[model samples]
Target: MIMSHLPYLISAYGITLLTVLALWLTTYRRFHQAKNKLDIMKKLNHET
Candidate 1:
């Protein structure tokens, strides 16, 4: 029956979720870093 494969299915889904979360976190961090750098540059430009 389908019950026999339940564990494998669960593990597969867990791995997929983890992978997606990791990718999202990486992209989010990079975006914030870039935004911060841009803000700093703008502030410096306006000081002249």
Candidate 2:
């Protein structure tokens, strides 16, 4: 019964978890990069 489909279930859950984690890491990196760029731009503007 359920035992027959156990492997399929486990793989599906593993794929979904990996996708969510990759997306989170990408978003986190992009956010910090954008913040750093913004800070640099502000400093340049202040210098003028």
Candidate 3:
């Protein structure tokens, strides 16, 4: 019955959610790091 499968469904959804969150956070962090690096490079170029 549906009730018997509830635990499996809940775990599957939870795992999927966590995976998406981890991927999002990783992408966000990398984007900021790349942006900072770009800014630093631009400043160096301007100084020269």
Top-lDDT candidate index: 3
- Cα lDDT tens digits, model 2, 1-48, are 999999999999999999999999999999999999999999999999
Q: How accurate locally is residue 40 in candidate 1, as Cα lDDT from 0 to 100?
A: 99
lDDT of candidate 3?
Answer: 1.00
What would the per-residue lDDT of candidate 3 be over residues 1-48, giving only the tens digit for each residue? 999999999999999999999999999999999999999999999999
Q: Is candidate 1 or candidate 3 better by lDDT?
A: 3
> What does candidate 1's lDDT look like per residue over 3-42, in tens digits?
9999999999999999999999999999999999999999
Name model 1 segments beyond 4 Å from true.
none
Q: For each predicted model, how many residue pairs clash, with residues at least 3 apart or on different chains?
A: 0, 0, 0
What's the residue-level lDDT of 26 in candidate 2?
100
Pairs of colliding residues, candidate 3:
none
Ranking by TM-score: 3, 1, 2
RMSD in order of candidates: 0.7, 0.9, 0.6
TM-score of 2: 0.86
Error of 3 at 4 (Å): 0.8
